[model samples]
Target: MVFSNKQLLQKALEENGTALTIVELSQKTQLQVAKIRQTLTTWEKDIVRIGPQTYDLKWRVYCGKTFRHTPQAIEIEKGILSTETDVYYYLIASFDYRAKITLYDEDDVAYPLTDRKQSKNLKLSYLSGLSKWFKKYNFEVNDDILFTCKDIKTHEFKIRRQKKQERDEFIIAAKNRRLADLVYDIINHTLPKQEGDMFLIRKYVYVYPFNDPVPPDGLIKVLANNKRFLISNIDKMYSWTGHRIKDFLTVGLRKYYLQNDKKDWIPVIIDTDEFGKYGYCSQCSERVIWESDIGWHHTKTDFESAESYIPNEFFTSDNSKTRMN
Candidate 1:
């Protein structure tokens, strides 16, 4: 039922199409002509004067990924080339009609964008002169060329090479999409072996030695919320670095056992939660294991912990306390 003066003006202009005369905007917005005129000056850059008492809020946006030049034509996606396919639809509908198309740089200077699939289809034109422009700008293959277009009668386009810090910003975006996976890989393989499953990803790079530039925010987000990791405490997160730990209670502790000092099979305790299972092994003289069966290989002299092999005293706390070694 109500709107701020700025909101009303913006709503009216948006509903009325690209450009609207002051009277039409005022009537739609329910604002007086003098008030609209006075408010227009404050939005100088956003509101443009294309004709008498007419204002337009320009639509300028980057068209596609900024790409380096190659011999092959730029592959622009259909939806991207222009938001409104009015021009394309018209061209297709009227086969005999001819239309003038042009591309403009920031300067008012216009170039013929009218070219066919084969050659210099762009107006004021880039074929032979494109190289000269690149030379003048000193752009590189890694540099990004931002492509944007303004709201105007014809095709109003701009192509400019990002410089210095601006180029860094573009590169950072690419790192977000691509380098994040590399960071994830590094985290996956070296984990559970590193400082026991608890460390900040950003600090991990600095704490440990690595060549990769510290992972960007994107990489951090992926590694932090991954499902493979069990988040012990969201308030105080730590990695599950003890998967392959030497201790008896560690989960998945058998990627491999830490080599035991004892060379022969001896007595050991297998802790299957409450069901106490005792066994023998060359791996360790006497140890408590969480896994009931570790699947060790042995002969009868090698085969340890058979059902009949247990001495009744072996269950006694007194005998269990004694170490054979």
Candidate 2:
């Protein structure tokens, strides 16, 4: 197997403790110095330049927790301070503590955050955070701030707020969304960690949209037609289908075409970084305006048009049949 550029650099950094020059790294890895420099620039989070020609691996002393590339925990706290679902607390450990989170505001600040699995109720994890920080951000019930775990050992996390247009914070509510979208969000969320990644349709009829529940028949219609949520024939269960293109925090750094309401294919330049996924429309400014593998929908207060995607989170690459998400 061939070593990737990042792998090569990581090996060199670990062996030498990051005291090598570009020329030395090139010789060790049998790569060009230009390539070495480029690799360092691209993977600076792993390997950083200390002095002019010196470098070091950016690692922290921690407990014996192996790191994994985890998806950021979205909708960390749905601004409403309530215990709505049992699944809400396990939301982080749902993926084996492999989650990162942060909240966006008109401005940003950082605080120490931690979660404790209660000895009394093993199922519930009591999250202790800076309650005053929420007040400082002035987060209304409509806003969502995702708090990502930076270090499990130290329980330290950072926060930042973007310009309103390029915000990671989505100021939206369920009632205002298209009826189809409401069902999608509810079912997508309520899908249990079961055999099929599915949810029972009738289970949520009265549970979803707490203020006003979706009609059981209409909810079935949304699930039946929407390709984003797939229906199991035998069990009559629903799961998030593999048709989302602009999955905000999960799918990253792939090119896509947004089919607007006019049916024009506008090329989208999507990219990913430490913060989160970004770049949907030249005009949308980091907003994931496209819907799952069907059509596009701007998720601001008022959503318009009917659309889906040809490919979504698990889409075929331009050059090959391999899936990228």
Best by lDDT: 2
Model 1: ten consecutive residues of lowest lDDT: 77-86
lDDT of candidate 2 over 153-238, digit per residue (tens): 33333333222243322322222234344444443343131222112222232223322221112232333443333233311221
Residue 203 error, candidate 1, Å: 40
Question: Model 1: how far is 159 from its true place, Å?
Answer: 2.5
Q: Weakest 10 consecutive residues, lDDT, candidate 2? A: 62-71
Assess the local accuracy of residue 178 in candidate 2 as a C-alpha lDDT between 0 and 100: 49
TM-score of each: 0.24, 0.27
lDDT of each: 0.36, 0.38
lDDT of 1 by residue, 103-200 (tens): 44455555444333333543221222244345556655444444433433344445565553553545454444443343334334542422222222
Alpha-carbon runs more than 4 Å astray in model 2: 1-11, 14-110, 118-126, 146-156, 160-325
